[model samples]
Target chain A: MKKLMITLLAALVAVVTVSAEVPAGVKGKKLRMALVKEWGTGTHMIMHINGAKSEAAKYGIDLSVIDANHNLAKMAEGIENAVINKMDAILISHGKADALTGAVKKALQAGIPVIVFDNDFAVDEKTANGKLVSMDQYDLMMGLLSQMALVQALDGKGNVIYNRVANVPPTDKRHRIWEGAILPTYTGIKVVNTIDLGTSNPMPKAQTALETLLTTSNNIDAVYAVWDEYAKGFYNAIVASGKKIPLFSVDISDQDLAMMQTHPEVWKASAAVNPSLVGRVQIRLALKALAGERIPRYYSMTPILVKSADLPKERVSMKDLAKLYPAWGSSDAFVEPWMSTLKK
Target chain B: MRQEERRLTTKKLDIFGFFYKYGTILVTIGALLYFSLTLDNFLNFNNVTNIFRSVSIVALIGLAITISLTIDGFDLSVGATAGFAAVIAAKFMVIWGYGVVPAVIAPLLVGVVIGLFNAFLIIKIGIQDMLATLSMMFLLTGISVTFQDGSAIYNFMPIPGGGIAEHTMSKAFLAIGQGKWLGIPIPVYVMLVVALLVHIFLNYTKYGRYLYMIGGNQEAAKLSGIKINRYKLIAYVMSGFLSALAGVVLAARLGSGEVDAGAPYLMDGVAAAFVGFSVLGTGKPNAFGTLLGALLMGILLNGLVMMSFPYYSQDIVKGIVLLLALGLTYYKMKHKG
Candidate 1:
């Protein structure tokens, strides 16, 4: 009896780290969480942080934000520190999975729930205290749609410029779709320029890069920027050249809306990730993991395709966004009943 | 027999002297010829103009760095200073909704203050110029991040309060970047004007001579009645002035302020300034040489990109160009000494 009890206790301890399930809810319970970001360079990211703050209020969670400013070592160190501090949960946003994997694994080993947003760790969902939350379906859509935007604009045959930074998870996700799903579909499309807009403010650099491309080759039909800022840079150069080439990209900000409205003819369309909702969703996943609720290893977001023609004459707000994204305000549809681990 | 020997030596010396003086120029012409022959559009008027217009910013910034290098100092903060100026100028119009004068002056004054800050640290605090300016680079870059709250400032940026930004680059400011003055880019003219003026000042003026003297031997210049500190101070301030000026033009050209606007130029400026060392075999920093350096890089970049080379390859080529230029200049200088 004693020997059998020892084996069972060992199994229980192992189970506690990886697959322990909570009874019902942890309402009114205060949990301290840390958010580690690769960089705070985008307005959408700022919005996401704000959403995390406001939405996290309901659960009375105290959030600490650490900005790595796109430094890989700093991002890892931030997660390591959070693990040392024994935060109830830690969420890392938009950092390289490989760089932070060891730190995140260590956190999980400590029985601290590690929730990730938009990082491609490719870790097994059954890992201890680890949850890879958020989805890339929307990002894939961004690529497909951006490609579609180019094809439609070019009347199904034209030269295109491809810009995306490899190793950046979200960018890579969209880029993979573009390379795999879209490029093959459009057999006539020729990539005249390829720029790796790696995780900086892409506007200025893209302008210079595109300007060089323009001086060298004037036969480009359209530009497919991985991000909207890159598109803006390309658009700026095109405008300067007095060319009618249109720009298509992903990500939407207030400035994007304004620029599109002002120059609708030049600006085509974009795939908008409700990063604000994604932020709230990230917080919800953190809370779910904290409560021992069943969470998927990979969660996906549905992106809203915002086009210049479909836009209203005035400025856009959250309510206006809700119409475009059904899951904009609530995280109900993403939540599910208890499951030990999610299958790929 | 002695006269014949002397003539042979002089003739041999002239051959080596010819290469040293005109190697980079020869190379520039060689590159132009190669690209012109190989790339169909490389020598097109519009393409050449584009190349010059694009390098105008690099040329202007390179000129500022050249001033510092001439005085035996280096201002690594030139790029960050440009970023700061760009941020504040954009903020003036896009955030605070101010007019053009404030937009322009705010960044310029900020530049002056930065110059003073760097000057005080180096001159008064007795820190080495490289070390002092290097520290200032960090501070200025951090300030730029804070100014925009770690995000880009564009027209109609979402304010924290509730609404969007209303201010934008006015026509006058946009014209500085977009408009042409008699078919030449305003920036090219700006580059030429600054280069010509600085060239005249450096080669023709006594003050400029004093600066070169201090650069050659600071203690010697100080002992010989030249105020070494004042000239060094002026060199830094001039760097600041021109960095800010470059940022203003960059802002005008970009039509919006970018925090990282000047970052790429740091390496490009370094290359251009070093390339200037070999120009005309001056073996010293000069405005005209720096302009040539900028044009060389501009043509190389324009030609390479027109050939549809990958973006990363462009960086490798730039590295090789800088390496070759510096290698040639350094060995030549060492052998001369």
Candidate 2:
């Protein structure tokens, strides 16, 4: 009876010890994670959250979320809070460089590993500061595709309105790439209106600015938005105004793809970033670190150019959309489905 | 003795009737109930803090419009003025490396200059308020674009050999945008302070009494020895100063001046200021009523976002709600009259 009791006690202790699996992705004994600004920009956040949740499962790790909501002050506070909470790792996506350094320093002081995704605040990608896991290479792809689209629509020469997202690093860098590649290549292309549509809520203001431009002159031959969201609004105003200007933009969301297929005036083409791949890679690297393995300072995610013509024929049917993107299954999702309701 | 008792009962009824005249209390209660039940994260500290942080700028801008609405004149240039002030603040901070106090105050002074210009155009040049302010909006936007080189001014990048003090100080400064005061956002407290002061200045003081009387009947107030044009000019200056102050807060929140950061405020200000009509009663714009208006809209936005509703659909919902609120208020007024 005593021997049997000892064995049973040992088994119970083993079960308790093995419950917290040093997850597949976490290299260290524990897991640490952080995300900044998760509201207003719902589409971006949802994609990120989906990736985070999936990776967290593969690696039995605890994830800490901080919604900066695009405020620099609060974002700093969030970073401080995460450090104080004794997180193992830190990740950030921020617009301003100065606002993020303090948080980065705090995390560093706490002896935690930090990885920056989406935007590099103070880290150098080529050096050994911290890995900048990003889709910036996609911007270069955007620049190339934008030029091709512009060329195809304008016949290599005409006035165009570059509805750009100014101040943002990737967007601004993409513009430089576009300018270096396109402006010198196509001399006949008269870049008439280089409107900096600003960063946040670029769409409505861009649409209004476009409408104003149209009223003043009919010389605008094409519209090029830096991102898919801005493209949606610009295309809407163009279609609604009964104008036949060819609209081109980068970044392919499912809605963007649907819009491209249906909008007669919009020739939508975007370089796609496989967020699933990014999530998998990020988790793997983080796990390696936890496991006391040396990893590269920076990792790059490759992007693919996705045209409307090259998309999957299996459209997310009304029935299956619920399973595929459950966030869109809500009744409220259909409220602003204008972007996807294009009847081609 | 029976008649005396009946008279006392009627007096009690009169007090209740007058007190319940404004239906803002009902709307507040409805907002509280709806947010509590609908938002999964509504009760959490994180979400509540987010709400206050986001609402501060709108509240300040709304108050500016509320002041103007009381005088039967609206400021369209307020939004552009905000953008211009933001750029100026960025310029002072980043380009000139000025001290924080000077960086903040310089932009506000420019606002005063623009406001004076606007008041001059309306009061002296005989331009209509709406048309004149609209032109000024266009002009100020042009100035901001020109100064910013058609791009946003990001002043927060680290300098060589500079310690982390630059970054820390800037973050500290930005905390003033929506920092907490006694567990409430600093902007909310600031709004309360400014609103109370303005309310007293407009309602309790003789100058305020004259200002409202002018709105009620301008010619009669002028005939009764009120300095009509002078008071109107002061109102414009006051609107300008508040708009400028709001701009500083926004700059801290946004952390930079993009080309058109303040575009939404133009329409939001109008919507919120006019919402005061349906707040306390039609044809009145009170400080308390403006706060209620901003709060109602803030709650609506928070609830909608929490429910995962798209941001664009908010316009349609707002329009519908505005129509309903105004319709109900008009119905009640008709019944009362």
**Sliding window of 10 residues with minimal summed lDDT for model 1 chain A:** A335-344
lDDT of 2 by residue, B268-314 (tens): 66666666667655546677666666666766766654443434555
Q: Tell me what fraction of the real C-alpha contacts between chains A and B each candidate also makes.
A: 0.44, 0.00
Q: What C-alpha lDDT values do all the predictions have?
A: 0.78, 0.62
DockQ class, candidate 1: acceptable
- Off by more than 4 A, model 1: A1-29, A122-130, A134-137, A215-218, A317-320, A323-344, B1-17
lDDT by residue for model 2 (A219-252), tens: 7888887776677667655764567888777765
lDDT score of residue B249 within candidate 2: 76
C-alpha RMSD for every candidate: 4.7, 25.5
Q: What TM-score results for chain B when candidate 2 is compared with the true chain B?
A: 0.86
Candidate 1 Cα deviation (angstroms), residue B22: 2.5
Q: In model 2, state the lDDT of residue A16.
A: 56
Chain A TM-scores of each predicted structure, in the order given, are 0.84, 0.76
**Candidate with maximal DockQ:** 1
